[model samples]
Target: MSSKRDLIIQAAKQTFLKQGFEATSMDELALVANVARRTIYNQFDSKEELFNAVIIDIWKNVKPYRPEQNDEAQHNPSKGLFNLGMAIANYWSPPIVRSFLKLVIVEGDRFPDLPRNFYRLGKEPMIQSIFDYLTQMKHSHLLKIDDIGLATQQFIGMINEPLIGLGLIILSDEPDMQRKEHVVQAAVQCFINGYQP
Candidate 1:
């Protein structure tokens, strides 16, 4: 059973992804959600707020690595990084997430804050999680990372550019498990080679 709020958010996500923010209407969202328009107002004051909620809702489901929760990240840099890489690859490779990203990019010019909010609330936290994990590894002397920010971006780029970035531009088949593992492994090895103390 879905709560009215959940239903509204789900409807908003699909609608916003399919239609840009300016084009999407509260009435349409209510129709798709199978709720009255007032139900949306009860949950969110405005479309902008609902849009932020949609981004927040998506990230809420994502389980990013936390150093306290995952001790493996502290002791084994390679294994931890591979897990991180796979998580990033898997999350972004999905059609829904990609579509949401495309929506933000396309609508960014008209709704200037859309992309910023998306990044600040959604991607920034994920990036910061990785950055924090890498900082922990550095502090533990597990990896010799002088510049945590650059290293974090490098590892993420290695996984994302080949796997997700390419898909964003051209129609392409999703990489199989073997290919994903290869990319993660190569990234982990390259990171280890450069940063290992």
Candidate 2:
């Protein structure tokens, strides 16, 4: 059983994904949610608040990378790095996420906080996870990195650009397993070459 707030959030997410933030209306959300318009207002002060909730909901739903949960990653730095890259790629590969990203890119000026909120909630944590892993690898002497943060950013850019630029932004064909493997492996190898002692 879903709570009224959950129902409203789910309904709004679907509407926003399909119609985008600028186009979606509170009335349409009310109709889709099967709740009175005032009900939404009772929960959220305004449409922006509702949209922010939806973005936070979506970010929450995306599987977070918890390296502590994976013992294998703790022991194997190379495998861990590859897994981190793959996790980011998988997170961004979802249609809903891609739709939200497109909406943010298109309407960022209208709602200036949308992109910042999304990055703070969604992207920052992922980067932090990778940074933590890199820090562990450095402590173990598996890699010699003077600046783990810069390396984390570079590694993410390497993996993200090819998949996101071609596959998502340019509307290229979905990358197959072979392509993903190659990209992840290449990213890990490049990171290792740069940092490995």
Candidate 3:
């Protein structure tokens, strides 16, 4: 049953990517999922809610790194910060997220509330996660400041600026690991530079 739900989500994602939100129908979603039309409603109350789920799924593999659970085998400040950078990279590099970027750019007006939902699931988690880690860093004297929210946006813009790409990401013929690493490295360094006392 869970697998069926996953399948429906995957199909919905593809459907949304291929056809803008305004064009996709529940019938099309059912066809792509290979499920009965009735089954989709059984699992999802509305297309909007289900679309929000599809967007959330793009970042599902990257869980929020809870320090209480994760600090058992932690390392120094630099290494810990670097790991967070890699996690951000991994979370945003997926094909699903890439398609999601396109949908946001092309269909921004069609689904008025989607941007809020996307930010709610995506940036909200990143903001809280960064705040938690920054609080720990604060106590350790690694960072000498408050105003985590503004700092959060700055660091995100650093690591994510290239990916932002005017709200689009273009995959080159070859995957560029060097380019990928550079964004994370620069973003992490930006935070360190600002916080160093």
- Cα RMSDs, all models: 2.0, 2.1, 3.0
Candidate 2 clash pair list: none
Q: What is the full ranking by TM-score, best candidate first? A: 1, 2, 3
Taking all chains together, each candidate's TM-score versus the true structure is: 0.89, 0.87, 0.81
Order by lDDT, highest first? 1, 2, 3
Off by over 4 Å in 1: none
User: Cα deviation of 53 in candidate 3 (Å)?
Assistant: 2.7
What's the residue-level lDDT of 36 in candidate 2? 98
TM-score of 2: 0.87
lDDT of all the models against the reference?
0.85, 0.85, 0.73
Q: Scored by Cα lDDT, where does model 1 land?
A: 0.85
What does candidate 2's lDDT look like per residue over 1-197, in tens digits? 99999999999989987788889999999999999999999999988889889888877767757777788888787888888888877777666677787888788999888888778878888999999988998898878999988998999999888887755566555677788879989999988898988
176 Cα displacement, candidate 3 (Å): 4.1
The collision pairs in model 3 are none
Runs off by more than 4 Å, candidate 2: 171-173
The number of clashing residue pairs in model 1 is 0
1-197: candidate 1 lDDT, tens digit per residue:
98899999999999997787999999999999999999999999999999999988877776665555776666898878888888877767557667777788888999988889988876786688889888888888889999999998999899989888878876477888898999999999999999998
Off by over 4 Å in 3: 1-3, 67-75, 163-176
